[model samples]
Target chain A: MSAPSSPVPAPLGSRVPLAGLAVALGALAFAVLPLLVPTYQVSILTEILIFAVLAMAVDVLAGFTGRTPLCHGAIFGVATYVVVYWSQQGGAPVTGVLLAVAAATLVAAIFGLLAIRTSGVYFLLLTLALGMIVWGVCLRWTSVTGGENGLRGTVRPELLAGHLPFYYAVFAVVGIITCVMWRFVRSPFGLTLRGIRDSESRMRALGYNVSLHLFLAFTISGFFAGLAGALYAMFNDFVSPSTVALSQSVEGLLMAITGGIGTLFGAFIGAAAIIGLENFVSQYTERWQSVLGLMFILIMIFAPQGVIGRVRDLLTRRR
Target chain B: MDRRTFLKTSVAAAAAGAVAMPHVARAQGGPIRIGLMAPLTGVVAAGGREMVDGFNMYWEEHGNEVAGRKVEVIVEDDAANPDTALQKARRLVEQANVSMLFGNLLANTGLAVANYVKGNGMPYFIPIIAADDLTQRNRIKNVIRVAGYTASQFPRPLADWALKQGYKKVATISQDYTFGHEQCGGFCQTFTEGGGKVLGQFWHPLNTSDFSPYLGQLANLGADVVFAMETGADATRLMQQYANFGLKGQIPLIGAMNMTDQSVIRTMGDEVDGVVVAAHFAEGSPAPVTQSFVAAYGKKFGKLPSLYGFSMYSGAMWVDEALKSIKGNAEDRDAFLASVMKTDLTGSPLGQTVKMDDYGNPIYDVHIRKVVKNKDGKYWNEPIANYPNVSQFWKYDPVTYMKQPPYSRDFQGIKKS
Candidate 1:
């Protein structure tokens, strides 16, 4: 089904305030949640913030670069654990995080370049294979990776022993990154990238470095993915290959699609929806995944653009 | 809808997906209605399904049903991930209205669900997934872990073997994660406590394919009896590498948790032999209960249960036996909980009396098992020694493990009923 798109009769400039107001409410809701909701809710919120960063990374790749990459979670998860592991060996956490990100960015760039040689499902398949390969390695390589026991620890400083500080820390980072993403989407560079996304050959004819742009976009996406991983490693105090598994990678796609791919808020919104629904469903049924599967199927069949897209359409229609 | 409208509509439609009213599950029949959540599918499918089967088998023979109501086991798949495990637990507690919740194999998931269940005032019991901290620092009320914590099983065996081999300057290479790091830490702690020196430690990405670097470093470290902590496919791979490096016989590898687990035996076959790891349970635990379990399991599934499967089998029956002891009173949340905390079951697979410590971890025998080929020509883990009646939580005092993380201190679950 076509998404409801009444030209945001309001220019994005005017809409920014509305979005800002919405974001403000969200932040406020989050701030008040610890008091009103249970500890379980707090844990779920922590998860949402982590995925928000992940989904935004995907937006840069699929929405801006217009390339469908499947193995981004692998890059993020690997970088996160490796960063933490290296740091334990007298490596600095910040430097470890940075190096892990840089390494993952390079890996993603190389993989993207090679996989981009093919398009459509073939490309998807290659990335999926890589993700599975990483997962297998995580499962197999014991001595170095802790095997399946997974990398566990406490990612707390003195300040993070309590929940509130960690919650806000995650929020601030996610909000700042989203704002940064907003700027990137509006920049000339972002516009040209969008142009490349729309028609790579035409953009190339217009003197754009298509491969370089794609490579650059891939690296940036990987960087953000790495950042998410690093944050996650600190948040959960552990990292496992499961985070980078194909299923996890697919979960990121589900979050993006569930919230509406192109919209920046949609990424977080989708994460909220999926994570929220999961929390809610699990609170009620052991068969929550079947419910989730049904929910996703209905969305695909009816609101292809997902909950956010459908909501936006309804408001415009009412107007 | 045009492009703009389509996008807008999609957003609106997405928003429309918000839930209408919150759902709640009321309590139903109570056969100590415990929700059993574990990995029923995926990579650990074989192990998980067997574990679930063992739980059911026990429930079948021994369950009395809570308060005269038929006991129901809400078997849910954890998918061996934290997020999914949490969800399944919620369903069992809220939707199914099970009085108690059970089953979490991984550490984070165990911590996550135990914390959640304790908050909601429902008792959650864990059959497997034995990280030291679960009972040590992260104890939650309404959370009873029946199995011995895995980390507690290692130190003595690791220390003894290291000393026997006259090994010093040890180095550990584990999967770079919590389970590996913590258990390996326990290993080093025990080794050093026994007058051994640790040279260095290395952890690799959990999903690494190449181990040339890990092995090369191990060769450089020159430590006797290299300690390995890995499970499932990872253990199998490391075992292969250990043999490939000619370190299996020469270096005398001692693995406490994953090295001699069921997954290792099945995954690596003949190569599994000679791998010594610390464990408290084995197929040959020697009790009539364990022997009967092996017999029944063998007759039914054409094989003997592994240490994990055997533990899970004993665990389920243990719960069933506890329920029977308390009878229908298990439906009473407080009464049932008190009964659960006071669990002291014997003649089970581990062939040792399992009495609850002040905290939930088992203060029972710790065994060192060596992988050996059985008459069936398949690798099986046989217990070489039983360190009977050892406290699983060595680092912490008895008072500590009862009220730990994932829960607040003074938590009622470990309040020593």
Candidate 2:
């Protein structure tokens, strides 16, 4: 099915006090969750935060550039493997994470340079192929990657030993990353990319280096995504071919579209809803996938623009 | 029809109830909680489900209580993903507060879980995964495997039996994962040590659908026997293609346990006739415990248990024996570990008494069986030979085995027998 024809109404004008109050209340509630809830709930929240970061990276392409990458998870997974391999070889954690992010961004830049020449269906297919190549390497390079047995034994920092401490660390990291991404999408570069999205030929005719802007945007997104993946690999202390599989990439895409495109906070809200439903629903019934699918269908049918987008439209119309 | 509106309301109602109800019912329990982490939904879902069923049947038979305490089972689906397995295990240990962990079916999941339990000091039992590293390179204090032979141990008897049958030269076809590498390496190492010539060895990628190229290469090798180590879908496809390639009876076929497992045997029919394998569990054993288990499992699940199901059932039974000896108080961790390590699992369907070595790997009989139609006119693996009291290293010294490189595709060290 196609995206909704009507675009989301941007809330970029003078800040409304009601929206600010809602944001404050949401932050307060999230802060108190670990203090009150069970450890399992805190773990679920950690997963949501990681996926939210991943969704924001997807938004850079799908929401801003009007290009959907089917292999962004592969980029994320490549960084994870890099960090895992480094740490397994007795490298320090800080250096391992840095090296991982740099490697992942480099791979993403190469991907963007190759895929920038293609558009539409070709872009999606090319990214899919690239992602599968990462998975194939992970599965075939048994000596280094452990093949299908998966690589384990990464050390977790003692500072983040407890569940609450890890959750807070994840919260702090994702919060800082999201704020930077917010400034990025609001910058002149971001706006020019949006214009290119509307009419690339017109932008090129106006002497804009459209290809260079798109490539940079893709690389920057990949950098932040690599950061997210490195944290995820450390959090689980394990890395496998599944982390880089196509299913994970599609999962990120679904989280972005289902949360609301073009909105930064909406990615987190979408992540919270999806991860919460998946973890919670599976507890009561093994047919949780069916229920999750049902929820997705209902959302697509009624709230075609996504839950956050639909809410924003209602508020805009009321005002 | 306002389907959108209806769906919207139903979705909201269902989401609110399903998502919110579990948290509210979190009162502390009275039973001794045992957590089972298995692949409930994935490529290995069928085997996982059967394993769960086997454990459940045994639990019910014992009245769902052990040593006068109510037994509570917390079932978590890992979906066969190593990352997910670790997450679910953490939830089980931290949230469910389970006393013990059980049933990790896949190899990587087992390794990851083994690592987690080792650090956390959780009492864990692995029933099915056969990667040799679990008992060798990755062995820890609190973890033990009660079911199935290690990948290296499985091929010892099969290689010896093949040599006894006068098949000297051999060709091997195995998947390229850890299980595959161990299987091919173990068989080749042992077969060569038995005064046999290795004509060829081929390693195929996991989930390979087309085996014609591998088969053609094997057909040209002129070996007297072909030893294979494919499992599940790969095994079925390889056997079917082997038949079409007209090499079924021209050369004898032997393999690790899973080549003719219960899950794939019926689909193979006469194609597997006279094919020999070394497995821990065989359906045609005539021991009283074997007959009873077969009858009860068949009655309960409408068929004989899959190797996974039987192994898990045996694992649960071991847990029961341990629990009875300790009277269900799992609080003293060291005492419980001692009791579990000393528990004797003898006189079962597996045909001999079982004991754990220093690394918590089982030392039991490995049945070298050949497939044939039984008196019931059904295909069964009848034991043609036995390697009793075999350890994980298959008679190799533990220190020397540890000194050698762990089995991989390129491994070439097998001591002369």
Candidate 3:
């Protein structure tokens, strides 16, 4: 989708070095952030990074595959509940992670099968309905989900218990996952998915299994979303119905849109913007929601392609 | 002076001033900062606003000072979301450096805050959340519910009243969350114990716009009375729909806490008249303390103080009393929490002495109130019966009560005969 905007690509010789430098600089900044900020702000930064992963997962479907899977929130939430429930049952953190990932992937596979058959608004509605089913289960299944009060008492592992260590651990995990997703989106399969997105009939004529490619893309997206959810559950050590709610799904999509949907790094920028605005702006004004809404409106109006897309456009135009 | 010298001197002076700021602040003995988290936006904004008003009214009346130290409240909007609540809580404790934490309006937010506060060991006094396990199975040592009651606390007394009124068979309808389950569980437990049967029970989602489907099932039940557990706008919608369905007069409606609370009842019409509900506070109580509070609140806020407002108002008073006991040394966390737990508030606005239970919950009067129109053409909860010195455990021993599972949809359901 962003290809047409870039009429001329930068030479690979210069692009590689520049991209590497940017990655190194970004990693170094995140590594030092906890030491620089207040103790509370470090937690906020950790949350931003975790949510950035979810936003990237949204981008995997919405940006590259040309299908918006609203059920990604439920996939994320399913992992969270799985991890919390597992930990509460005395499972180790590593085992809990596997369980959470597998559960989230399974749910995503089922949702993909059901929703992949449809496209456009039908796909959106199907995904929404599927997500609501998960939410309803989380709410009504009081025996497991604890109803509205939610499941609590998941202690952080001793190794990552402290704020600094936990932040660093999250930083490392999120860093590794972002790199893997970066590779996935650049792979041949990713190209095929994008091809299908641009023209499903052409991709089909070219011998690509369109539905299979879309399904695989969705499942991979759910994998990253589940990992993010597991990290979040560890970060907060609490999970509630709110985690699986429709608002959560909407927020993830907003993050993706605000950050520039297809740009992988834009997810982090979007997460930071929304989280920062919610935390800091609220301290200064009681009408923070209005302020956030206004900011969103301005962004949508001025940079419809999103913050990163606009930045990229400006950079390319200058070049 | 040259421009360089002038600029250098100004910069040096500014740096020195910044360095000296902390010492100056310490010398002044910083104000006792209390962090309040509430749903200042979203669905429960009205209840959240009233809670803040009531809390501030108490402090405002006392000049915002407690035991020679100034009191400063930092209010944060949680947006009724648990994650946001936890984030705001961290901001309050670590960033704002509040001496204590107060205010949460929903069960989810309350539990989230309690969990976070447990790790930090911050003294948190919940004013409005009614989650049962906060005081029951999962009581946190550092968390105290000053003006809060468990979801089941108010309804337990109403159950006995229902049975006494010859309502042998009853139907129940409540919001399908922790609070609702616990509320219905409490009433059913006591009602069934008193030889009354709960014929049917209906659980609806929060913010349910239509109660017609549930009302349809209710009409077929042919039960002696219908007990409803709803709050805020849900209560208003349920009552209005009940009247629309012509089920109000046909079946006696018994509400759980805040069903016809002053905040919601004012929006309702005559259909709510004579509906019986039980709550910890009655806005229309003729007691001197309550009357004075009503008059002062009306003069200031131009409305009756709902249960939300009254709870926070009394919570502020409780905190003030605790601070006075410690001579306002809120910085001494252990001493302050100890003082809070040892509180025995006599002549509180509830028209009785409010005492603290062993599990960090309050033991106070539960009033069985009836909705009525006053001479001023306002609907108020009139105290029809008062159950004095009620605990969250009701009639059972705390140890025995703790042995049973925390109330859920099926755990305390009526037995099928």
Better of 1 and 2 by lDDT: 2
Q: Model 2 misses residue A206 by how many Å?
A: 2.1
Highest-lDDT candidate: 3
Please provide, for model 1 over A1-319, each residue's C-alpha lDDT reduced to its tens digit, 9 standing for 90 to 100.
1122234223255457766787788777766765554444555677788898788788776656666678988888888777767755666666776787787777777777777666557767887887777777776665556555455544445566455677778778887887788888778887787777667779989998877777777777777888888877766656666677887777887888788766666787778888877655543454567888998999899887666667766766876
* RMSD after CA superposition, every candidate: 10.0, 3.4, 4.7
- Ordered list by TM-score, greatest first: 2, 3, 1
Model 1 residue A67 CA deviation (Å) reads 7.2
> Which model, 1 or 3, shows the larger TM-score?
3
Residue B37 C-alpha lDDT in model 2:
88
Query: Candidate 3 — which pairs collide?
Result: none
TM-scores of the candidates are 0.64, 0.95, 0.94
Best by DockQ: 2
Alpha carbon lDDT at B290, candidate 3? 88
lDDT of 2 by residue, A1-319 (tens): 2233245345466446866776677567677777777777788788888999999998888777777888889899888888888888998888889999999999899999988787678888998898899899888888898888878755567788788999999888987898899889889998877777777898999999999998998899899889989988777788889899998898888888888877666787788878877776666667777888998899888876676777877787887
The CA lDDT at A91 in model 2 is 88
| Candidate 2 residue-wise lDDT, B18-119, digit = tens | 232234232333577889988998888988898899888878988999888888888989888887788779778877778889987889898888878877
| Candidate 1 lDDT score at position B134 | 64
